[model samples]
Target chain A: MKEILLNSENYQPGLSIDCVIFGFHDNQLKVLLIKTSYDNKWSLPGGFVPIKEDIDTAAVTVLNDRTGMQGIFLRQFATFGSIKRKDPNFDSTVLDYFEIPKDAGQWFTQRFVTIGYYALVDFLKAIPQKEDNHEIIEWIDHKEVPELILDHKEILDKALHTLRIELNLMPIGYNLLPEKFTIPELQKLYETILDKKLDRRNFLRKITHIGILKKLDEKKSNVAHKAPNLYTFDKDKYEEVLKNGLNQGW
Target chain B: MKEILLNSENYQPGLSIDCVIFGFHDNQLKVLLIKTSYDNKWSLPGGFVPIKEDIDTAAVTVLNDRTGMQGIFLRQFATFGSIKRKDPNFDSTVLDYFEIPKDAGQWFTQRFVTIGYYALVDFLKAIPQKEDNHEIIEWIDHKEVPELILDHKEILDKALHTLRIELNLMPIGYNLLPEKFTIPELQKLYETILDKKLDRRNFLRKITHIGILKKLDEKKSNVAHKAPNLYTFDKDKYEEVLKNGLNQGW
Candidate 1:
């Protein structure tokens, strides 16, 4: 395909979308971060808005570029813009890491505005695909989240707030868990994000009554305690639950 | 206080918030609209980004300007910008109304990139204040809606979609109903919006269980049939119910 260009010398001034891809592993809610090829410091998985692409599409493209994943559950959590948001220091970490001249930074961090989107994906299914010259990818737990390159920390917090609301209104585990998982694992995921203990029996009853889980007769291979039954989400039933606004308790 | 310049020229290029305010009266959903003092025909209530304002605040400003109401529920529904979204005849209604000066029209239209928000308000409470030059205000019901100024029909559709979801998740009647109402009055509001007949007894049971209503000892007066008890929204209880994300059904 021939390369398409519009006003080639400049990127248009308009809205841009950024994605904060969140996942759960080892009982900790984590976010995917990339070390920018331009500057080696960490940044959330993100990209520029395509001239023809919708803002939502732009966010999905960012997710696809960084993780080689698509069709995941993504949502617009918030939009962040301030005159201060465009400060050159927004990409300072990248500049410092590459030992580039101060003047070179202008080529990238010039005036621009961004809208933030948050997404949830199964950690096991997300394969990090670094673009050529890009640095390694990392999944850092919320506690260990370092000072991200720019306004990313604020973006991540907004994503988490949106995620919590989505969880109560949908069977959120579908995007964050394997096809078949034990009830204990499901409970762990909720406890991790909510940071609270749940009565296992009540949680089990609620999930089962929602009729989104089909219990499997399988048992754990090895464990100190009695093994819990494995269950898989009934996709059709779950979709129906979602239509009624996923009334599950947090 | 010194008068602040609120024109678009005084601000830097940034994202702005536009509100699509909807009201239900006389058997149809109505939108609060105005013709700009400088232009012709109607458009959704909207405004520019205030220098120190959060984008959400900008949306509230749009709400306050046209409706003279505040602290009601307003939600950011979507962001609309495609390169072509800037075209002078983006939807033609505005172009023909303004009799666009061919040269300048293209430039002005293309400059804006707006994030859309929507709110549900009781028509009785909205006090429309003219903000711009061609500022003729009216409540245009959804069915009788004209070819709106620009991309506004799309904006209104999105607002409807958000309101539908909100209705299913919670009792959102406080925004649409008068302070004193009966169970049937509330049910009628839902039936009208959702366009479905609900089981009367079941609907009443569900809403009462939410515990957000303060039932008055006095009953409805001058009705052809048995009068239902009047009720007001219990703010404290409603806030408590919000913590519980879902329930049986609408």
Candidate 2:
């Protein structure tokens, strides 16, 4: 037991923060991912938490460095820590041919306890940047997301779950969609996230009753059927509802 | 900057987990507290995380030791860190009281980064116990709580804030009340935590519509005025609703 306990001394410990930035496009939810320039491996945009910084601040720094957006809705979701999760091979098949070391022989697998935060941003508003000039950055739809470099797929899954659970109560989907969206568009966002279909009339009625959507007289220009009226979220009203909370839908 | 960083090495490093256990009784929301046996100071029931253990597991272990409950509704709410949050107060307090050399000063402020977990429990079902037999454990209503020894009061406040924000969607209140309670009892509990008065009839209607309450034929027999009907949370239904989400309330 003593020897086992002492082994912890050799364990290099550190903290890191990862941002699972979610975006919505083409009626599908997506996460912003960077294809590492070094190894062509894809993963969530992340970085080490500085010793002098607040952990949440470190998360924002990571997001801003990669996405060039500040003051976004960044939420600390959960902290991931499994001894096996720290294994370098835990990354996807892309690393198989890299001839990486068994352990910290690779910098990526060093024992790190990472606090995961999710950011909901209008993809159009995000000016994606390559930090440390690594690989290509892309926004992959959640459904078709690649087998990411590390436990990034797992991280993205967790962020989606948090979003689904917090969707109605918090002002989230607005940040993921276009500035102006129809009721069907908004409903489709919820449907994609929750992985379920909803009665269109019921969903529309509920959302409209919330009193945060400003109905615009404009309609979908090119759609074949009757064009649905466009609506935009009243930012101030949405913020008020978020601060006070609503009890209508999951 | 290099000199300041080097001077920080003189501080020992450690990690801690704080459990903010919320309990409800007599229509008042309360929190479980333990008076530190070390200095007769009041604080939340918390302890250091074992190096080999997962942080969440360590949180559950500490909580079970303090509350004698297993697998309750516990959640990692936030992580607290501040340079001064880990000053050598405990050792100094002890040394000043005993008039001893502060040789063991590091024993007190060992630069700890503590992750905070907020838990909800049916106080009547829990068997509270002290990890250290000498620790004085008690339940104090939120308003009546004492000035805690460390940053515990802030931890408790943050936990409550998380609960209030989530109360509309999650069935967390069930953890604070008994297996059977009146609608009024549940409403009172919410009012206490939210620090506001809710319309009684409106509260009942909203609570019942969630469809998680199983109304029993029983009633409060000896209470003054009209006796209220007894109800228990439909566990299966509650779990289902959690998946579905409770999304409507003012």
Candidate 3:
């Protein structure tokens, strides 16, 4: 396997794609990470770009394989290409663990200019399917992510930074909310991300006026019998409302 | 040179950096392009990434070598990696132009996943430098850009798109404006980018309120003696004000 990977004909040399699969669970932003069996070290789900394939296509393929197709909202954010981006300690550990490599480790040891991609997904939908070499797969809160292999930690931090900027600048709101959620749940999601309290009646009054929230027909909620138990954003309607601008006072 | 390039020991194989050097002049956005002596074909100011150098460092070096050090605001926006992004016609032309033996041309013919960087610079600042293999070098209006080699046209379009979005979403007002300019020149620059005429009185009234613009004490304006002839943005102060937010009606 090491010999096959060392061959340059199969993949583009010194280029890779790492996916920062973000999910919102327990009101916290989470990142999907995998533990490789070789070194039992955490790493972002990533792979080399096949010689004949596009970089983005490689990202999608790698993401699907890692998460059983969880990364639906994909964006190529930035590239990490620093000479010292790789971790020498991680490399030595992996190389020492798998002793079939000396000269064969050149491909694995070279400096890789990795394209960083972020994927926004609902946590429930990510059914992680472990690869043959993966010892563990888990979604850890962004704030609590362990020390990752290579420059994965730097890549993860950058993805979160871009996400924060996007949330502040654009009309993309609460995209990580569950498939069907109550208004209170939606409000909680907003409050969690913003890290501030909101007036209950005022929040309800202001949000209802925009009419982007569609009341889903479901069982009554424990808190409010008058309000539907579940509601979802009418994505098209929400976007249409946003075109004219919505001053939600964020 | 051809033999050396084909050998992967010198450079990161299949990875390149293409720079979109944007300048606003004559009320139109411009991009710097170089016509290669190899094919006499127009291309973005670009070069291959050396094995040891960072991708962004490579971009700065390439930009400086091409434009005598004018790309001051450098940002890596996207990566172009379509399998068919390369121009086979260009490859044949260059290979035939150089009369390189078929085997040695592999380096030129292979697919390169290029990192796209956009540089916001004052147009007059970019003094075009002809590289050893460049037949011609010019900064052409983006709208009037000639057919560029490879997928550079797509890359250029993305850069312009990002620029427009940035201008609209943030307090990045008239960054393309000259270092020092009068109210009228600033208004003209904004109008050109916005693609619409703004009311003269309303423009001045609204712009002056933020106090981000500082009047230079050099001279009085040609239009009105009461107004300063040249004004420049207090970038630091402007950013400080934006921290609280500025609502410039688009």
Chain A TM-score per model, please list them.
Answer: 0.85, 0.82, 0.79
lDDT for A179 in candidate 3 is 60
Pitting candidate 1 against candidate 2, the one with the higher DockQ is 1
lDDT string, candidate 3, B143-180, tens digits: 78888887888998888777655554455544466678
Model 3: lDDT of residue B91 = 53
Each model's fraction of native contacts:
0.16, 0.21, 0.59
**lDDT (C-alpha, whole model) for all candidates:** 0.71, 0.73, 0.74
Find the candidate with the highest lDDT and give its number. Answer: 3
- RMSD to truth, every model: 4.8, 6.9, 4.0
Total backbone collisions for each predicted model: 6, 7, 0
Error of 2 at A189 (Å): 2.9
Scored against the true structure, residue B247 in model 3 reaches a CA lDDT of 43
List pairs with backbone clashes in candidate 3: none
What does the lDDT come to for candidate 2?
A: 0.73
User: Lowest-lDDT window of 10 residues in candidate 2 chain B?
Assistant: B1-10
